[model samples]
Target: MHSVQNTLYVMTPNAYAHLDNATVRIEVERETKLRVPLHHIGALVCFGNVLVSPALMHRLADEGKSLVLLDNSGRFKARLEGPVSGNILLRQAQHRAALDTEFALTAARAMVAGKLRNSRSVLQRGARESADPGEAETLTSAADALAASLRAVPGAADLDTLRGIEGEAARGYFAALNLVVKPQARQSFALDGRTRRPPRDRFNALISFLYSMLMNDCRSAAESVGLDPQLGFLHAVRPGRAALALDLQEEFRSVFADRLALTLINRGQINAKDFDEREGGAVMLNDQGRRQVVTAWQERKQEEITHPLSENKMPLGLLPFVQARIFARTLRGDMQGYLPYLAK
Candidate 1:
């Protein structure tokens, strides 16, 4: 299995990257700011306006590392990788399963089960922490709704039925997400529901940014295991969509991103002032806000958690890679079935 390692993020707008004596050198305003050995990094993620020298890019490819480019607000722009890794047979198995209705349904059920279970956990935690009786009741009810959805997954007869169950659980989860925010901060950070394609609120913007980060991590994990990240059973194939990566992302969206976003807002590390409203009523994080969120995100990735299935403690950053490896094993017919990551 591929191991998880450090992911270098360059969020500064003017930062330039190049190779200097087998190390990645970062410079801004013509002054060297940081230097990291290439061997220590798993990926180099650069945000808006960061320039990567050809020499550095070639060296990273040679070292089997990834170079992911994102806009300032954490939108995925592009990704550069070395030669594809992993066994060809594994990918062939993945493709065959993707086109099989039974295989797709099984895999989708595992993924959506993980999502609902984690979403329920988030709501349960919120209910426990909430002082307001009404808010606590609402959160508990949502958690129950998610639990019902989880029970319904195995009974889903078709793709559309499974999607309907997933959508209902998501709506119930998001409705309770507002209670995750502290009462005093609700006016500034109320989350009505999930929104994308230019999020309409600060809460949605934060969720989008976090989802983008998770997507990149999932893509890297899939590539590391030699799986085609673009071909997935849960998500339909579409032009330029990383379907497999997205399918993997569903499990972690609640446990990782949603939890962190709540921590940031409830703790007052992020506030309304950190967002900017653009034309057409779109909302997004400003530069300072992005930096704060990214730094916190990196630190959060370092935190360790125990895997329920493997029963091993590992860094949070390794979760996606571990799940990908397990999924690959299932596709290869080495395992009986896929086991989604379950939060305790």
Candidate 2:
């Protein structure tokens, strides 16, 4: 499976029969179609409108593929096999072990700071392509501020410190973005904004969408490793919060999502028509917009990049792989730390 490029995505409003083609086919639909390849599938995500065939239900229990179902609101409804059946005592110990101050702080800092720095890295790259020199300077400055915050994170005592750094970094990043997108009155991004019609102004909308995709990718990685998604290190343990998913997503929000968003904009892969402010107080991507985003995300998954810690070859698209490895090590007691993945 490692050697195989076996990620298949299907998004169809119309019904279609399942083909006996790939090992895993992620079907996201409003209703059910044919029998799902549960044994073959590695993961599945359905957003609101989906009806599962009886065979697929049975396969879920037997094959135990990474099955995750979400409601219309995108909250996790059901998971096929997310819990461990190992010795209760060992599992309890692992859970408690995870709460130690050292482990907690290390993981949280790495994720938060990684995300902030990656965002800076992406913005700087985008700045290079900005049409205006002033805009580029602002972006570079934002990137620098974010970098400084990231460097000051190792000694952060609590989540509040992490949050402060994150906030400051975002402020700088957004300040620069406003300049890049100012000429386009229809486009803008602000740190302080509500999910209104055009949930985010053109610029912010794209960034927010990119952020969502990044979070999903990180969640997928954490789920694959069988860790409790709610027991997070950085974010507070709120009810129904995918705390661990939030934690994992921290490192990726910028690394994957921001990079993709900029590429789409600079390459002319997406435009204003891709967004819709149809409803009041909320904005969203049109079907075409979602399609384009997913295509770019999938393309990102296929690209390879270097690992800063391992100093070995890994996928640029393998943010999940990198994350899963971190979790696996933490669980096995092989490593006493969780390090954020960084570029060489």
Of candidate 1, the 10-residue stretch with the lowest lDDT total is: 1-10
Best by TM-score: 1
> Candidate 2 clash total?
8
List runs of model 1 lying over 4 Å from the truth: 1-4
Error of 1 at 63 (Å): 2.1
Residue 28, candidate 2: Cα error in Å is 12
Residue 180 in model 1: lDDT: 82
Those runs of model 2 whose alpha carbons end farther than 4 Å from true positions after fitting are: 1-8, 14-39, 70-94, 178-198
Model 1, range 1-344, lDDT digits (tens) per residue? Answer: 01135788887778899999888889988998888887888789998899999999998888888889999779999989788778899999999988889988999999999999988999999999889999899999889889989999999998889989999889878877998899889899877688898898999999899999999999988988899999988888898999999999999999999999999999999999899999998899998888888888887888999998878999898999999999999998888889999888
Every candidate's CA RMSD: 2.5, 4.5
For model 2, what is the C-alpha lDDT against the true structure? 0.61
Error of 1 at 44 (Å): 1.0
